[model samples]
Target: MTNRTFMTVEEVAAELDVSKSYAYKIVKQLNEELKKLGYLTVAGRVNTNYFRKKVCYSEV
Candidate 1:
């Protein structure tokens, strides 16, 4: 029930077609790799928001 774009571990796993256990592992690893600022976690949870390039091209 949060308005954040970030998804939970189980949600991400479903999106990636993986098991919850694996999802947990992946999220943990991502956390280590990201080491991002404003990292919000509750009671040891795996959370992440994938990043992407935003290309802006104007038609001439």
Candidate 2:
């Protein structure tokens, strides 16, 4: 990845090797969780670190 703090739906899809539609769903779900925690979220984008943690994508 490019060391960005956030990942767009496109980037998420590429990273997960999933379809863009599916990636949008994932982003929406994770954003909901973040909202519950009192964090503001951006539509069509997610925090990269949170994404890695949620999906169990350990650093290599």
Candidate 3:
């Protein structure tokens, strides 16, 4: 494993090869999904494990 618990928008952009704005959009979507599940989320940041689990099953 990794030491990371969360990822910033910039890191998400690089990891997904997306623009920062797009990354923010993606992060927002992730956060929304989490909120639907009763998880609290922070703006501009996402849980790394949660991202992996969601992205792994999606087109990304």
- Winning candidate number (TM-score): 2
- List candidate 3 stretches off by more than 4 Å: 57-60
Per residue, candidate 2 scores C-alpha lDDT tens digits across 1-60 of: 899989999999999999999999999999999999999999999999899999888562
Query: Could you report the Cα RMSD, in angstroms, for every candidate shown?
Result: 7.1, 2.0, 3.4
Q: Which ten residues in a row have the lowest lDDT in candidate 2?
A: 51-60
* lDDT pick, better of 1 and 3: 3
Residue pairs in collision within model 2: none
lDDT of 3 by residue, 1-60 (tens): 355878899989988899999999999999999899999899999988899888894443
Misplaced by over 4 Å in model 1 are 1-3, 36-48, 51-60
Q: Of the pair 2 and 3, which is ahead by lDDT?
A: 2
Find the 10 residues in a row with the least total lDDT in model 1: 51-60
lDDT of 1 by residue, 1-60 (tens): 353555577765776688988877766766655466556544224443331111122221
lDDT of 1 at 43: 27
The best-first sequence of candidates by TM-score reads 2, 3, 1
